[model samples]
Target: MKFFLWVALVVFFSGCNNSEKENTEINGDIVYDMYKPSEMSILMNEMYDYNLKIKQEILEGKTPVNFPTNFLNIYTAELSEFKSRNETFQAYSSLFVENQKEICNTDAHSDISERYNNAINLCISCHKTECTGPIPKIKKLLIN
Candidate 1:
């Protein structure tokens, strides 16, 4: 009788494990539903990384020379479901691009540090109205 009870318990545990495996598999393949960021989200992350590099270069006393042409995609990249490309967003984005250009196209009188800081400020200001989540991270991009 004890042997039979042990066998029953083993079978129950085995079945439970198999059921869990089945739940995670589909047609013999394990599939995961990963969160895919929107086009605008991806672009924004790239922009942040690019700006961080620019900030480092500026701190090192080097002016950034390459303007990421892809930055212009902000005008066309698809935003998250909750965000819209409204007039305010458009205006801020335009200003951000202009500031970025100033950082790359250094003039004899242009202060690269100030231009970089202005670009970072535009990012902060835009986020304040649209997506407040990234404001803190964006603030770190400032030269000072």
Candidate 2:
């Protein structure tokens, strides 16, 4: 009787593990990481790196490279749907759409400065509503 009880408990726990695995790979999508404060911070770091690369391009007298590519790839790659909410990353992404034109166009060098400032501003704005305390770093990204 005791042996049978132990077997049943093991079976129940094993089934739970299987379900958890299923949730991780939902509908062919691999949920790498969900949108949270930590993940967004990392995504923001990618944006900073992209900004540096764009600066290099400007120094060499070339067009602005695709900043969105670097930012979005890292952001999306780390996003997964939460239990109910869509994802906090959407906030950053929503603001990104407005800057897409400037971000993708090398011809927008003169415009890129404002666009860069706007991008940093939006990052702070959204993070304020979602995750505050990173405003200092975000503000530093804005052009003087």
Pairs that collide in candidate 2 are none
Instruction: Please provide TM-scores, in order, for all candidate models, with all chains considered together.
Output: 0.74, 0.51
Give Cα distance to truth, residue 134, candidate 2, Å.
1.3
Global local distance difference test of model 1: 0.75
lDDT of 1 by residue, 13-93 (tens): 332111222224579854432335668878888999999987888888888788999999989998645456899989999
Off by over 4 Å in 1: 1-34
- As for candidate 1, its clashing pairs are none
| Candidate 2 per-residue C-alpha lDDT over 36-116 given as tens digits, one digit per residue, 9 for 90 to 100 | 333534666667677656655545556665445545554455422232324665756666655744655655555656666
Distance (Å) between predicted and true CA of 29, model 2?
39
**Ten-residue region with minimum lDDT total, candidate 1:** 14-23
